[model samples]
Target chain A: MSFRLALQESPGNPWFSWRYVQDNSDTILAALREHAILTAEAMLIATAVAVPLAVVAYWYRPLTGPILALSGVLYTIPSLALLAFVAPYVGTTNPGSVLIALVLYALLLIVRNSLAGLNQVPPEARDAAQGMGYGRWGRLFRIDLPLALPGIVTGLRLATVSTVALVTVGALIGHGGLGDLILTGFRNNFYKAEILTGAVLCVVLALVLDLLLAMAGRLLTPWSRRAVR
Target chain B: MRSENPIQQALTWLNDPLNWTNPGGILDRLGEHLWISAAAVALGCVVAWPIGMWLGHAGRGGSLVVLISNLTLAIPTIALLTILPLTFLGFGKPPVVVALAVFAVPPLLANAYTGVRSIDPEARDAARGMGLSGWQVLGRVELPLAVPYLAAGFRTASVQVVATAALASFVNGGGLGQIISAGFGLGISVGGGQILAGGFLVALLAMLVEAVLAVVERVVTPKPLRKARGRAARRAAVATGSA
Candidate 1:
């Protein structure tokens, strides 16, 4: 009993426990801030660019192939390689460069989902809207967008999670959020506390973001949640 | 601001014969990168494939599998790689392999499960009606139908492994990242060029892997399934599966 108690009480053995976590609150919070800022900026930018382009593709039809192809090619680039590739041009410290690269990743995901969301809007709903005197633009804004919300949220959720992972790769850019601690630990001053804290905090941040988004999606799109539920 | 001529330097870097033949040269590094990445993918398959297959065959836990895969996907690979060395792993290729394999599992499991679950219920019913036992139905029908999805998953895992394997250099695990990090270690100038050169190599390899896997996916999908499965369709299959 004493041996088990001593082992459990050891700070190293209980790294993730409430006791140990409090000791590293500062380190954890810094990483959480970096992770959140980069993720939000990237998602916001990707959504802004992707929705318009998706609308254009939906409207034009011809550009669909090209847009898809371009995004597909970009997606094939390794996340780390993209960071390393861009680090030289952007300088390591600027978060904008990381944001730009991360935004490129969300492009394909958001665009496809946007288009799918719009497309998946039942023809009946649009027809019913038109019959009720909703004009083209009004139909899109009032009917299509709302109906498409579920899928777009789904896409956004995915983009957010993916970007979370990529932010660590951003460490190479020297703007990396939780990644800097891990990389610093790996390279110069090897410390289990920093590495463990960073890893745990990064994962926790992702989980929190994921839960928040999922809850937000459910709350905002009650209609879709009904269907899904 | 685009100041450096990384493309030109990358070209020169590639053209130089010395880079290929020297000890720890590009060729050796390339080989090391491939096998190690491949090994990680293999390890991922070993872990994920059975669970995926069992869940997929039972037509159960699709949502659970997907949920777990999503959670797994959210973990930063660099964080995994870094923290692993602190967990009795120490800095080396083994840690790299473990980290890469951890990241690789989600895609593998998600696609495999999705592939099986996506099959027409009628087909499963027909196979059962035809006097096939559970094992027989799975072996003869569902697993075959899942080949394309499995292939797609493997491809995603392999490419991601190859691309990120460059990070192994951070832990003194040798790969092309060694050269790229050396460039960054210098802070600018020649480093910029090497980073680009290194990135281009990694990107090109990822594309090549993706292209090859695409062809394999096309070939493996049964002809009728292939009829509806274009590049976009295949991509949607893998994306929504993992998503």
Candidate 2:
């Protein structure tokens, strides 16, 4: 029983029932926008760095082992530990901290898939392209790339889902979006509908994102459609 | 119990069961976390197993499903945990469980699906030729064959759930996370030690599960693979001797 609630719900009640939900909707919405943008930016950054590295690593198998091993070690580190480790360089409250972690997590997937996809290309196909007087770049684009598209797309799809989910961790830093609502519910002492609402929305976001990625994978790999039949 | 002894004082405070009282106390909280994780993983396996089986039979869809599941692997549980309380309105095990299930689903589904899809075409065709119905064939042939893969999936999901369940503390759902979080309170050594212990305990529980499953996997591996493995070992020994 607080003052705010007594004024609104029951005059005798003293509880100040602040409508956190009402007050925070706009903030959450704004955070979602930032989250989406952050995810996209991180993916772009990670791809730009990882894909070329993967290609070069593919050409030299020795580098692939070390890069992959590094990614595996990165994977073992808990997300919070990684964030706290890097908090000094980039303020934790900012979107950049979470975004950077997301990119790091994604690098392994992108690099592994890229290298695997490239290696999966039939050697004869590349030979044929080379025989056609295609240089290294031409062979890569014309012959090797199309074959590897499926794996690359697979990696990107993985990276996207991961980034979207990870962006919520940024909420601890006072970044908005659903995480803000959930964290508030937590700090406010107990379960209220507001917290559950945010969580459900996040799960829905994940499920919807998963389906969209699946559709995208299908579209990207037309060959798969035939292979299924 | 009040003493000038620093080490004894810390030990008594830590060992005191009375410290963990209240509604969301330490011991009760750890129990809640395990319960939630166990429930969610059990439920996830039920859903994932069938989907995995169906996907395995459906060829072409294998990579696509794998791709989708892999993507889900990317979404951090912490983010999901954070968003859950807000969207679901007041955090509890339900949202946490859902988040965990999403995390656990990919490995189970992917492994189960791959197991079925990767079954020898000859074996499937032979089963079909014997007039065995699709369901029967799947039950008798496909499933037993896929056990090793399913076990692998289960192993991955189990460890994942245990580790991620720590996030449940963020939303006040209580678990080992509360102990860990409480350790962050004051005296860094006191708090940090608790957190370390809780993390170690969770890791140990997860490893125990993995080891038990590894035994099951070893048992499930076909006799031929075991025989071949022995032969390979013998050949290696002989080659080394000759060299």
Candidate 3:
């Protein structure tokens, strides 16, 4: 018991405290779960919005510049500032404001990637589809979108990683998942172990998610693998 | 106050002269924000560029470096800002600058590496064939061609640094974020206008920096490459339109 007290009261506080982890395992796990859910939901909504926007931009030549430019502007806004701007309207009772801001932040990368992916579909391929009597919609779904999948997936990966990072800022308004732990630790006398756990978990989650997405992209586009080989 | 439009109140708050000039005012915070961002980006460039260029020249383990750097993006900025202070670094600007600088490295390093690696082999050969030493070849042929990529990296790093700099206020590293946090401290009823104003200023500043850096990027790019890119863009647009 005295040894534990001595460990706790040591002048050089250790960065990784097993005591802290053992004490607050539930809280840590809950925060990690919340962080993952928030990231997944944000990515889902962002992709849904981004794909249509990218399609519109690709189809309408004149709108492409404006659409890309608008998303670029949105992307430049700081995550915290965007959240604060959004919070007033959404009332911050839920994570609604955080989700909206994340979706906006994510639009640029996904939309750009989707458009690039669409453009990468060879004109010859489209012509072949047309000669085969495929309708415009059919060609788009069968030829264009499939070709674009890799790029769109790449965009999703990038957006998801960034969104995961940005979600921590949501803690400023009390919606930040693991960010809450980091903030609470800071507020409570610079609790190093708690802060490190949150920080490390965020990076781990990001890397694991990124790896999973890359693998999924490979599975989705098996042709890419064959071409490389 | 409850019935009044928040945006209108925000505009009024922005227009107030006292908010612009007083101690810890908008101007002061903006200065702090710019100072931290500029310092961070400069430091990032200093540390990342040399290593990136060396690795690119060496042509071994460069991708691994880039991958590792990109992985750094996953590390939460808030966590870094908050956690750094716990070390001997102590509170305020040190932690903020270090965190922002770390954030800036991935882009700068990746771009620098790609910029050098992307150079045409024949051009490098021609420079070498012209009796240029290894260092001379790099300086005269490689560096000039890499300007566009470096500019792109700089622009990305600067814009991101500026935007992320707002979090500096969290660690007592004063900036535009202070206004936002201060407004939050005052509660929505009393500080709605201030919050809106703060957000607006930060967004405006970030956009302005992006625009300025974009223009700078255009100016710095080699003239022939710029024209070629412009032509390619036009061709792409035409192709897409006809399709």
Better of 1 and 2 by lDDT: 1
Q: Candidate 3, overall lDDT?
A: 0.81
Give the candidate number with the greatest lDDT: 3
lDDT of 1 by residue, A25-91 (tens): 7766786788789999999999999888877777689998898788877777877677777776777
- Candidate 2 wrong stretches, greater than 4 Å: A1-25, A84-96, A132-147, A189-229, B1-39, B54-99, B125-136, B179-219, B223-243
What are the per-model DockQ values?
Answer: 0.44, 0.10, 0.46
Top-scoring candidate (TM-score): 3
lDDT measured at residue A42 in model 1 versus the true structure, 0 to 100: 93
Quality class of the docking in candidate 3, CAPRI style: acceptable
lDDT of 2 by residue, A95-147 (tens): 67677777786787677777777888988888888889999888877777778
Query: What is the lDDT for A140 in model 1?
Result: 77
Query: TM-score of the B chain in model 3?
Result: 0.90
Shift in Å, residue A29, candidate 3:
2.0
User: Is 2 or 3 the stronger prediction by DockQ?
Assistant: 3
| TM-score list, all predictions | 0.89, 0.66, 0.92
Point out the worst 10-residue segment of candidate 1 chain A by lDDT.
Answer: A1-10
Q: Which stretches of candidate 1 lie over 4 Å from their true place?
A: A1-28, A132-135, B1-4, B88-91, B229-243
Candidate 3 per-residue C-alpha lDDT over A6-60 given as tens digits, one digit per residue, 9 for 90 to 100: 3343565678888999999999999999899999999999999999899898889
True contacts kept of 1: 0.59
